[model samples]
Each structure stands twice: as C-alpha cells, then as structure tokens.
Target: MTESKAPGAQSSYEARKPQTRGRTRENTPLRHNFWVDLKELIAIPDVASRLKPPPKTNKRLGLRKTAWCVFHQVVGHNIRNCLALGFQLDELVRGNFLKDYLQEPQGALTTAAPTEDQGHEVPIHGEINTIAGGFSGGCTVSQRKKYAKGVMIVETQGLDLTLEPDLVFTKTNLRDVVSHDNDPVVISMVTTGRKVHHILMDQGSSTDVMFWLTFNKLQLSLDQVRPYVGCLYDFAGYQVEVRGNIQLCTTFTSDAASRTANIKYLVINAPSAYNILLDRPALNRIRAVASSRHMKMKLPSLEGIVIPMKSNQKDSKRCYENSLKTKRGVCSVTIQPPGED
Candidate 1:
C-alpha cells in the first residue's frame, strides 16, 4: 500500500511548464488578388433568384438578363440558335467572349491546313471567296481564319480608320491702336445726350481714346485742335504720342444711369486703321477701367463695367483693386450741352 498521491498534483505541475511550445505561429501578410475579387463579385447568381426574371426595359434589365441566362436553360438549342431566338446571356460571359473574339490577332499566319492531309489543298484566296459568298453561306475554315487574321492586322496596324478633317475657324486678336487720326476717345452726341465711348477703357490696346472719329463724324474741324503733349504707355512698356489736342463736350451714360464730360482729344499716330480708342489718359480722365475677365468697363460715376470675375474670387478682387489703384482719382469733368451752356 502506497500513500495516495495528492489528487491534482500532476495536472497542476504540467500546467505550469509553459506547455511544450508547439510550432510558433507566424503572422503571414495577406496577399490580395484584385482580379480574383473582381471576377467573383461580378459572377452570375445561382439558379433560384435567376428564374423569376423581371421586365426587360427597366433598370434591372441587365441583372434580369443575367439571371435568366444562368437559370433558364434552352433545351433544344445551341448558343447561335438561342441568340437567334432572342435568349439573353449573362453580361459577363457575353462581354468576355466579345472582347476575346474582337481582339486583333498579333501574329502573321494564325492557321494552316494539316500538312499530313494531302487531299485538302488550302485555298489561298479565302477571304475574297467568303466576301463573294455574301456572309450568309458558311465560311470555309481557311477563309474564317484568314478573315480573323486580316481584321486583326488591320486593327493592329491602325489603318482601318479614316482621319477626320480639322474644322476650326481662326481669327486674329488685333491690338486696338489709337493714332492722331483715330483717337479712341469717342463722343456720341445724340438727342439722348453726350455719351463717351472710352476706348481706353478697353485694355487690349496699344494706344489711347479720343473723339477723332466722332469729331470727323460730327464735322468738327482741326481748327479747335490745340498743341498738346502727354506721354502714353502701352502694355509692353512702350510710349505713344499725344501730340495735337482737340476739346469737345461729350455725354456718357448707361441704361440705368448717365453722365456728361469735357473730352480733350490727343492726336494718336497708330500703324493700323482702327476707328477710335480710349487710351489711358482718356480712361484716367473719365475715371474708367477695362476688366479683361469680365469684358466690361467700370466708370467712376456710373456703375462700373462689370466683367465676369474668373473662377477664383480672390484673383478677381486683386485685379479690380489693382486697376482702381493704378488709375486713381483722375477723371474728366462733365460738360454741359452747347445750347444749355
């Protein structure tokens, strides 16, 4: 007889031994297969949900077509017959088959007759024969192979498509130049009142504005012209001539507002034949500025010409502020009508 061992002694001792470290488990990083997931996710559904199909023309038509093709079997027909009878196929399978069939062949000779068979001479002009047969007649194996190969060649060579002709219209961006003859500052004296067309308010200029055209149109002569000298600058930092001067009374106005001003014309000698241009001096005199973005004018008295600010409001603000500051408080005095005065 042996003293009875303590009941739980062996079990407790075994538990304390850090349990024979069976192979240490390693954390292998998961390898993701994007193509595999895409394939599985787009696979057709199982039979049951597929059988009870929905209407054809609605949003679920694709899904319904897919389900119908998967679950509903055509007992007595091949794929061609099924297609002829208007049976839909799963979109994935159809698209895949189309892509593969439509793929341009890369190699020169895709198929040839079995050399062992001496009786079967391969036709050299297979494609022409098939075309002559008008596609309805079954194409010979050789012909089909040639057509596929030729089509692939054409596609791969990028020679099958015709180029479209360019149909764009081109125009010149003429710089408005004010000369002694065609002063930009124009005065339209009508029954409504005297309106000043400040050509200088247009920045796409190489010269300034005056009423020379208006003066000529109004039958005003050069006798009123006085000797005047003022330095004018262009966008490219080039100085322009402001030699001879002619004074006139002009009225300026907009639909909702109006103003009158005394316009002093400076002779401008420009290269091109432009009618009138409002140079910086005339712009400064009328307190006007041109906004390139908005394609409008801003006058001191009337509502400034509103040009569409560009996409960034901050840039637009900067442009407006810069223009205003550069041509500060300079303005022409509004003159009264001849009879009224």
Candidate 2:
C-alpha cells in the first residue's frame, strides 16, 4: 500500500543466460517402474481389520415363505414374484375346485339318461326260435323290446358259434333250398402244375374264369399264354378283359358212370375285388349245379372232369363264348350235346 509502483517497472541488474531453441535431450523428466511393485503390494491381506456380516430385518423372509404369503395375499403379489417363489396358482385352484365341483348335484351337466337298449346285453338263458323263411337250415330268434329297433336274433344248435355270421340267420345251409329251383354251383380253377384248391368263383360275376394271380402262382410265364379278348361283367357293372387262355382238368362222376372232361378257360385281368369268377361257361363246361339254399354245389361227375395240361384255341373260344353269354346276365346255362354244335 506504500506509494504503488507502475505495472512494467523492473530491475536490470540480474545475470542474463543465452536463450535455447526447440527441445533438448538433457532436460527430460525420469519415469519410475513402481506400477508393477504396486500390484504386488495389493496381493497381501489387510493386517488390521476383519470382514463384517450383512444387515438383517424382520420384513425379509425365505424364498419359499415369501412366495406362499404373496400367493395367499393375491393383492400385492404379481405373477413374476409367484414364479420367482416357484408357486403355481392354476394347479392349486384346479385341485381345490375339482373336489367341490364333483360333489355338486348329479344333473349339473344336463346329460341324457341311458335307456335299457343303450346298455342291452345278450341274456345267458335266452330262448332261440328259428325264423320262418331263411336261406340256411336254421336261424335264431330273440324278442325285441317295444322301443328297440326291429331286429330279430336267430340261433342254430350244434353249430359252432365262431363259424356263424354276425347278422341274425333265418336259415342255415340255404344252398340246398336255393339249388332246388336255381341249381346252385361252385367253380374252381387250378393251373396245370399247381395245387388243386386254387378254385376261384364269384356268384355276382357274369363269367367264371382264371386270373393272373393264379397264373403267376402256377409259375407259368407270359409267353406260354395266348392272348384273347373276351367280355365279362363284375359286381360294379364294369367290363373286364379276359386276357389269356388256360385249360383245367376236371373229373366228373355220377352213381351210374364216371368220365373225364378237359375244360378250357379264358384268362382275365381280375383285381383282388373278384379273384376268380365261376361264370356259366365254366359251370356248363362241367355240368355243375349250385344250390343257393344249402350254399353248396353238386357235381354228379366231378371226379370225371379232367383238365388237361395243354389247351387248344378252338376249345378256348367255345369256353369264352359260353362265359360271355353267362356274363350277359343269363339266368341258367346248360351245355348242348357235343354233336349239336
């Protein structure tokens, strides 16, 4: 505060050194390697104090108890908290509600009451009466309740239950009765070398003949077959091709006499729907009769009908024409005498 001097006034008596230009190597500061040493120091435990425990409060609870309380409260707790506590609300509600729901009244769902027929069972001691008109020899009868469907039950004695059809039967063995009027028949075919049970027959088919399945089963090659186009009708009214030709050996015998007949058959592309058809041509060839009443065919000379190993084209043509006529919906077929044609 004593008489202030001006801002730039200074003394000139101090020593003056020469001014240096740019940076110089001699004036640089030194750096220490203490960082590596500091890391080593931190590795040692503190020599003074021990670790302390965390704070505790009455409001804090175990995870399971917290979840249980939160679930029971249902107000402040949310699904996330319930999941964290491992609590399932839906399962708990279902278990408790199911017991209560089942204990309620019986007609809660309004379901219909079951009728007697709905739970009907066949009686052990039920009486069986044969129906009046039946194709077979025997049928069983069971009385139907008023409200039940008009179903009659037929029973046959001494017959195996397992062999019977599921439907009620008015008669058993109707082939005998049906043959009296319609002349029932059965026709079967077997290739030359194969076994004899390969008979194929279909009542619904218009023609009875051999099929490729039997041909293949017989181990006969296609080259051995002669191609022939012939007509046949199936159950569905579709026309099928009689592909190749075959010859069967049949033996026919009657009480009076016995003879062998060589029968030729046309091959047809028969699907599994109809494997082999015993048409009128095959029936007329063997002079066979089918009885619808007894479900059997009678061949008086069945043993004498002989099918040869080789077939002739002329004989095959005659068989095909007969089968065609049979397939055309003709009711009956009778072979004309050999000299007539």
**TM-score of each prediction:** 0.27, 0.30
| lDDT (Cα, 0-100) at 167 in candidate 1 | 21
lDDT of 1 at 69: 26
lDDT of 2 by residue, 264-291 (tens): 5556655542234565555655555554
Q: Candidate 2 has what TM-score?
A: 0.30
Q: List runs of model 1 lying over 4 Å from the truth.
A: 1-207, 211-214, 229-243, 269-273, 302-341
- lDDT value, candidate 2, whole model: 0.35
lDDT of 1 by residue, 1-341 (tens): 32333322221111011122222111111112122322232242431222223223322212122332222231222212122111122221222322232233322212222122111112122223211211111124454456667765544445322322222212221123211222222222232233322223433332334534445545656677676423444433444444466656655555545545665555544322223445554555656554443333445443333211112233334434444565332222111111210
Worst 10-residue lDDT window, candidate 1: 129-138
> Distance (Å) between predicted and true CA of 37, model 1?
52
